[model samples]
Target: MRAVRRPELRLPELRPYDGAELEPEGDYDGLEFAGTDCSGQSARGARFMDCALRRCALDETVLSRARIIGSVLSGVRGVGTDLSQAMLRDVEVSDARLGGVQLHGAALERVVVRGGKIDFLNLRKAKLRDVAFEGCVLVEADFGGAELERVTFDDCTLARVDFSAARMKDVDLRGAAAVDIARGIDRLAGAVISPAQLMDLAPAFAAQVGVRVE
Candidate 1:
């Protein structure tokens, strides 16, 4: 299997942003949003390039259809953060604590997610390419109808993930710490897993094929 390409981010000197409130369709470039509370703010269709969001709050922040490129989000905490239909490229997200986030129809490329705990993430119909998730805990993440290419899960815990109607190519799950699929286990056509993982999922596989083990 080919290795997943990681994001190569080189952030320039950024100006500190002390903005009062997020504006819709705002254009922010080379800015650092440090310790900013952006909860319940609407930044829909905003564009953020070469930016760093460190220790920022994103609860219920609307980033739908937003474009985020060459950015880093570290230590961000939030619930119900919406990134639906957003485009993320060459981004690194680390140590983020999020729940019930919506990311349906989003496009992610060359992104690396590390050391984060997320729950109830909604990624239905999203497109992912060259993405690597490492050392993260994901619970109840939905990937229905999503397209995945060159995606890898290393040391990550996937619990109750749904992949119904999802398409995959070169997806590597061999390094996952744990894996649990609540639905669509038969849709793993182009995914790679370890023999131990296959054994662990044998019951599910048998159930799918209607083979009873007595």
Candidate 2:
């Protein structure tokens, strides 16, 4: 019964940017861009509604195809922020210090990323639905070919997280404390982990199915 690849955000009926200087196709509504700097701004196709961006710097900002609704990005210090094909709905990114944030083909719905320290966050081919990354510190976060649904990674610290060719459904890392999967463990087929994260990833799934657990 796989039918929850949601992300068709439609929030572009705005005319209230009220700018203090953020003008590259700008259409921001209900704006409150506190401490705005918008470093190296491009902001292509920008359309943010209900916006509240505090401590904003947005270094190397591009925001391609942007469309953020109900946004609230606090402590924003976006480094290499491209946000390719962006469409984040109901977003709430707190304590942000986005590093290498490209987000290729991005389309996250109901996103909530708290206590962020995102390092190398690419999200290649992204399409995450109902995303939740609490207490994040995602180092080397790639997520190649990503398409995760109902994504959850609470208390995260996932070091060297690549997940190559990812297509995880109902993805949850069981309140992740320390997940160090550098590449795809068979793309984490139908991911929904518990049981102590499958016994702490069972020695990297028994060395990728060549089991010899003596």
Candidate 3:
């Protein structure tokens, strides 16, 4: 991994100076942490703009009510972090660990989560509009009470994911495996599926009706 460039505090783009180890002591705006270790910290009502967090360990960090825009978080380990009430837009987080990550009441737009084990994630009451999950493992994830509009799951592993009480509109599940689709039946809230997948699930449907469709 390439070394991230340090932010010049005197630059006009970066403001409200806060050290890597020092907490802002209060709500701060436009905080930046590039090429640093900010693990096991609590940042409340903070915002990170144009930050590059490469190879950093943000494990067990609590970033409630925070917003990160246009950030590149490559190789970040965000295990069991609380990112509730946060908004992440135009961010790319690949080769990262997000296990047990809680994103309740958060909104993700145009974010890419590729090649990561996002197991046991809590996305309850979250709004995932225009978000795409590609090539990621979403095992036992809870998407309950979420508003999923125009969400696309492409080539992703969605085993035992929960989407209960979510309002789904125009959700695309094309190219997703059949095993993954079956797990999304009750969890899909009110989302619609393809006709081919519906036809393929005839046997499961028949069994529910007390009929053997062998």
Candidate 4:
């Protein structure tokens, strides 16, 4: 990693923070930042609305108590980052890497994460509404104690993922591969897998139900 420097990127209602790495900073509401690097920094209580974060790296950054409404966070890597108590609405995160990211107590409404690698991502005690995970690889991701409503996992790889104690309503796990479904079923409490998925997960089904496979 090179020396952390804030780049010149402009967004609506957004301004560059001029200072040596801020702590205990204020909020940034309705701001957009493009091609910026806020990596390895801590942004607490920052609120962004109608904002766009293009090609930004928030890796190892601490974003506690932040709220983003209708924002686009494309191509952002949040590896080993903390986003606790954050609220996101109508957000889109594409081509991001969230490996080892922690999102405890976060709330998301109408959020979509596409084409991302989210290994060991933590979403404990999070509340989700109308969230979609599309074309992503989620290995060993944790969703414990989450309240999920209308969440869809479309064409994603979900191996070793845990959803124990998560409240799900209208959640769809259809069209997921057999190995992925097997991992998901390990921690599923209140969810339904499609019949087509059952056929694909025959190996796991046999293992779970004590049925011998010839």
Candidate 5:
């Protein structure tokens, strides 16, 4: 297994952010930023707690080293968003389009991503615990060198998803609608899947060991 490239996220003392300009190292708690256009905004090292960000256009937004907790993000379009080294906990994101999102070295706990399209999501070297991706389409999502514990994919499409060098424990894919292990199928030794999924992945599994089915 390869070593994970972890980021050193050191946030200073947070103050209040009023969503006026580019505020770094600010704290935004219990705010309702619904139906707002916060595109191209930079909120590095900000802490958001119990916030509601529904129908917000956050395209190309920078949220590096930020911490978001107990937030609900529905119908948010965050294409090309950068969330590197961020920490998200107890957050529910639904009906969002987060293509080309960067989440390298981030930590996610008790997060639920439902009914969304997250193509080209970069989660390299991230830590995910008790995360559920339900009814989502993750095309070409990269999880290389990520640490996953108790992560589940429920009725989701994982087409061309990469799991190379990922450390997975108690990861469940029984409810996945489509599974495409683009790389590192051998490294998923501790993953749990249903027998039906196993049957569906038999060809890939056979090809991995250089076995010929006659």
Candidate 6:
């Protein structure tokens, strides 16, 4: 089994970001956005490097096509956060409470999401590499046509997740607390699941293969 590479972040001394409305295409570096309310802020095409956003509200915040590198987003809460087509590398998102977050066509590398509750996450056609979700609850996440590599879910709860047309490689789902697939039950070729999970998904498997268990 190929091991996932974790992010090695060495953040330098950071400056505090002023609580001002985020501007589009803003360039932020080595800054800390703590307790910032970024609701309805549009930072489209922005660049964030070595930054930390702690306890920030991101409701309807638009970060489309933004580049986020070596960042830590913790305790962030919001809904309808738009991160479409964004590029996130070496990022850690912990304890986030997000719903309806749009990450379609985004590219994530070496990202770790821990202890979060995300509902209606839209990752359609996203590219995920070396990403790990630990102890998180993902409800109704849509991964249709996404490409996942070296992705692991450790003690995570995935409910009503749609893997329709998704492609996986080295994806480890053995440590997931629950795996409830709402669609694409037959696309488990490149995933690793435990025997218990296989048993739990037996009905789906049988249905996929047209097996009748009377």
TM-scores, each model vs. reference: 0.99, 0.35, 0.77, 0.80, 0.89, 0.99
Superior by lDDT: candidate 1 or candidate 4: 1
Cα shift from native, residue 64, model 2 (Å): 17
**Model 3 lDDT tens row, 19-117:** 556242334344445545667887766776766666677778878778877766677776888888888877777777778888999998767776777
Worst 10 residues of 4 by lDDT: 1-10
Off by over 4 Å in 4: 1-25, 177-190, 202-214
Candidate 2 to truth, TM = 0.35
lDDT of 2 by residue, 93-180 (tens): 8889889989888898878888869899988988988888888798999989989888888888999898989898878787788888
Q: What is the C-alpha lDDT of each candidate?
A: 0.96, 0.81, 0.68, 0.72, 0.84, 0.96
* Candidate 5 lDDT score at position 31: 74
Off by over 4 Å in 2: 8-12, 16-37, 40-58, 61-67, 70-79, 82-87, 90-99, 102-107, 110-127, 130-141, 144-147, 150-161, 164-167, 170-182, 191-207, 211-214
For residues 67-168, write the lDDT of model 5, one tens digit per residue.
998777889997888999999988888999888999999999888889989989999999998788889999999999999988888899999989999999
Write the number of the candidate with greater TM-score, choosing between 1 and 2.
1
Candidate 2, residue 62: Cα displacement in angstroms equals 12
Per-residue lDDT of model 4, residues 108-143, tens digit only: 887888887888888988998777788988888788
Q: Comparing 5 and 6 by TM-score, which wins?
A: 6
Best by lDDT: 1
Ranking by lDDT: 1, 6, 5, 2, 4, 3
Give the Å error, residue 48, model 5: 0.4
lDDT of the structure predicted as candidate 1 = 0.96
Off by over 4 Å in 5: 1-19
